[model samples]
Target: MDMEQSRQKRSFAPRALPHEEYFAPGHRGCQGCGPALAFRHILKALGPNTVVAEATGCGEIISSPYPQSSWRVPWIHTAFENTAATAAGIEVAYKVLMRKGRIPEERINVVAMAGDGGTGDIGLQALSGALERGHDFIYVCYDNEAYMNTGMQRSGLTPFGAFTTTSPAGKVSKGQSTWKKDVPAIAAAHHIPYVATACISYMSDLYRKILRAAEARGPAYLHVLAPCPTGWRYPSEKTIEIGRMAVRSGVFNLYEIVDGKKRLTVKVRERLPVSEYIKAQGRFRHLTDEDIAYIQRRVYEEYEALLAEAAQI
Candidate 1:
């Protein structure tokens, strides 16, 4: 056999795959949508005994269309700003049913899923309420940084200097000027049982976190950085690549908080310039050199603060 042929054969070796299914094929997600990939991985970790309460966002629209659905498990499409509230109610109902011998405790795991705009912006109040009440459920935010379902509008989680339809660049200013919200930290502040940040590019890491969160006793939150090719103006194939670059550039990090202690799970092994990630997306095309430098400084500052918090544990 030739050397090239042997190399190709080695690359195609079989590997262990996750044994689970939730989001099925034939959905309406955009090509290479990171959130779609995330949903698949998370459900694999969660297994079949799960019920999802989704908000009125991309996940709901893409997964559940009239006359057909992509979600195999029991799922509910709630209002835009009430996913967390609805999930909390589901958790309460499950406990009540279990106590009354009407439902088996091992038969279902309740989860709430929403986009960044829904969780970080519109539904934040309900999320806070659920955490404070100590509900036994998992809330997953597939954060693409903006409201992509509504024509790429700016959300509170959107990063500085990124162009959205609402925060369009003009003569007076570049794109969105405000920094992205620190959602994981906010979730940690609630002193929930578990809180973590994940990315679609790191499938194993994301899956492990979801599994851990599912087994916890009290409320848990998982914030996933799901890239959007259509909204970010990048090629469909670049979803995973850009998701990895976001973490490597320090713009995003993988970490968890348990019992009020912060822990950094994945560090930037070989740091890359933020521009490499930004320039690849059309949203940041109008950013000047000064703007890029400002973003870099912010990333470093945020990372240092995270390190300090994690060290205290």
Candidate 2:
């Protein structure tokens, strides 16, 4: 990036918009695709000297086509299940190359990017291995909540009571049966140095987490809550609003786990009802009043549990 571009990226003023453009405009992503915005902020924090390993998902689909590309940095294309493994190899190769005097001492940040389906389901084993081996890299999972690229299929990260092609709400059944997988908590269990949750609407928070992950020595995991307009059945314009509602409703808590402490960054002391959040999306439109009440209880229970965990920290 140029000097002016650099200044724009580093600008942290809450009101002033970021001038630097890392992901670049014009891509195959649908209107109001949440991952598109998340990728933009991620590249801003990592800067130019970064090696990326993106899995076979929306991030790879929309950005890096065979003949053309969207990424301005050195990026490698990897399979859905081995994105973390590929990134680990790259990180090792970089360090070895540096020691052998083949490369400069300037640190080259390594990041593995994947969608929730890749990271939480097919890619889980490879991700666990990379973290367990203590690779110096950051793994970013942009969670659109389901397998959006192919069809609106339910994945491990898909929330309960949400309608999907695979989990359609029928006369005898509700939507998705299981709760969303707690990927961040799973990452924390690996004893990683840094793990955080970010939403696409909150650009500043997302940028901060990316930088934190980049600076960490060992494996770092950043789970981003990127809303899917097409899959979630919401209007394109309400993408940012839905994201904010997720956080404010305490449904998608924006918290960071650092130095063994879990602190809620965006505090919702008197959180809005889960109904307010569910009613905004078409995926949850089939939910009944009783279903909404159950969801609200689950949300409150999870938030309280997080508070208890934070207290111990």
Candidate 3:
């Protein structure tokens, strides 16, 4: 369906999002920070019984400082490379406590959150270990594409031809020389019970996926595409719009893998040209016609491949 039709048909929730807030106000997130919005929704869906283990990234810095915190639920800050490991430990500890009757026998959700750098680059080993070990928790990678908290450095998950402090578009190179890392596929390779891709632009789908992930028995992985206004060189107010464009142009997609089966959650029947998405951001300003075409070709190929994979289910 068309974008307007999709919008009209959207049902964000059977009811409105919870009136209660688990992520408190007074946090110092940037204007139109996608990750910050993501955190709010995450807590709202998981509720007060959830505990979050956040890595040292944008999400950590924005919500927690030495003397202050924005989280109403239990939250812990871990190193950039050990968020998942720490969350796994927490899950084990909670299980042990409940079994020993030291704590009430109640369900408590455990979640690990990190940025793209922490997930795909610095924290890959720890994350892989946790998933392979079958930890009963959720791992969330809020991908803004680059290391936005660290001055827009190129990261493993950064899209090809996207400009960053390290990957500048110049005479020698167009931008990042490599394609974005397929972290979701890497997570699914472990045969996790649930793996999903989401974007903040589609709140209904995102919320639904998070709830499903929380309900999964074993480990669950969610890769959320969070657009960065600062790092992506877009107007702060356009963060959600840029994200929507990314999905509609096939630059990003929404899908989920359940028990080794793949399915498309939000299908775009008529995708706009990739240029529509590219031109909205300054990061791709230096891209030439050839460069854009190359990027578009890759997007089309990957999206088509995703469709084929989902069709098998």
Candidate 4:
């Protein structure tokens, strides 16, 4: 094969196919909801021996209505701000149950699932405590960049220029003027065993991270970039495509922090301009050329900084 063809083939790694579906279909998730896909990947990776603790968010709401649930495994519903605490309790209880001979000693992974609102904003304390206490569980944050389940309100993880109901763009101000909070960095700060960022477009990258989190973990964290159609003001069918663009445009850099080392998982050798990503969504419509240029510069700077930091380690 030609060098160019080989390099092109290397751009995307083939998906590591899953064996079983822990999340059954026929739920209320909007078409192309990225978190729904993330949940499926997480379930596919964790398997039947997993216990999920979910916060009151889109995933729990859409997947589990009164008399029905999408989860095939044991699932516990927790408050929006207490999923990590609930998962920590489950971990401790599982140990106690094992000691009493009620359950096998083999580990049954407990995963705390939440949205960006629950993770970076309300549930930060619970997550911090769980990680600091060394809970043997994975905390999954399916961040759509807003409080989408509630009312598309802004959250701490929202990017600098994204529009939301609360942080709406106007003549006086741009939407969400602050930087996106680095949740994985916060998890890494706790000196956890594993911390990673994953997106739906890269299923294999996400699956490996999920499996690794489930298989071997001490306060592992997976921050997933879930694109929301309603909140993001994009077509439902473009979810996966937009996710791919986000990564390719360097809006979201996929990486993992393991044992104090940072590694970039997927690299777009020649990144697409950030405009190619923002132009598709109405959320960024208010951004002027100067605004976009500023954001583009910031994005590339951060991407380069990440590369330099990874290289040093």
> Which residue window of length 10 is worst by lDDT in model 1?
6-15
Most lDDT-accurate candidate: 3
Q: Compared with the true structure, what per-residue lDDT tens digits does model 1 show for residues 70-120?
A: 988899986999898999999899889899999765646799999999999
Each candidate structure's count of clashing pairs: 0, 0, 0, 0
lDDT of each model, Cα atoms only?
0.87, 0.88, 0.91, 0.88
Residue 232 of candidate 3: its Cα lDDT?
93
Sequence-dependent TM-score of model 3: 0.95
lDDT of model 2, residue 151: 86
Each prediction's TM-score versus the true structure: 0.94, 0.94, 0.95, 0.94
Q: What is residue 75's positional error in candidate 4, in angstroms?
A: 0.5
Candidate 2: pairs in clash: none
lDDT of 3 by residue, 127-146 (tens): 99999999999999999999
Off by over 4 Å in 2: 1-11, 14-18
> Which stretches of candidate 3 lie above 4 Å from their native place?
1-14
Sorted on lDDT, best first, the list reads 3, 4, 2, 1
TM-score of 4: 0.94
- TM-score for candidate 2, please give it: 0.94
Q: Put down candidate 2 lDDT per residue, 1-313, tens digits, no spaces.
A: 4433434454344443446666778779999999998888788767778888999988899987778888888888958899999999999998999999998888888999999999999999999999999999999999999999988899999999999999999998799999999999888989999999999888877776777787788999999999999999989999999999999999999999996788887788788899999998999998999999999999999999988888787
Q: How far is candidate 3 from the true structure (C-alpha RMSD, Å)?
A: 4.4
Best-fitting candidate, measured by TM-score?
Answer: 3
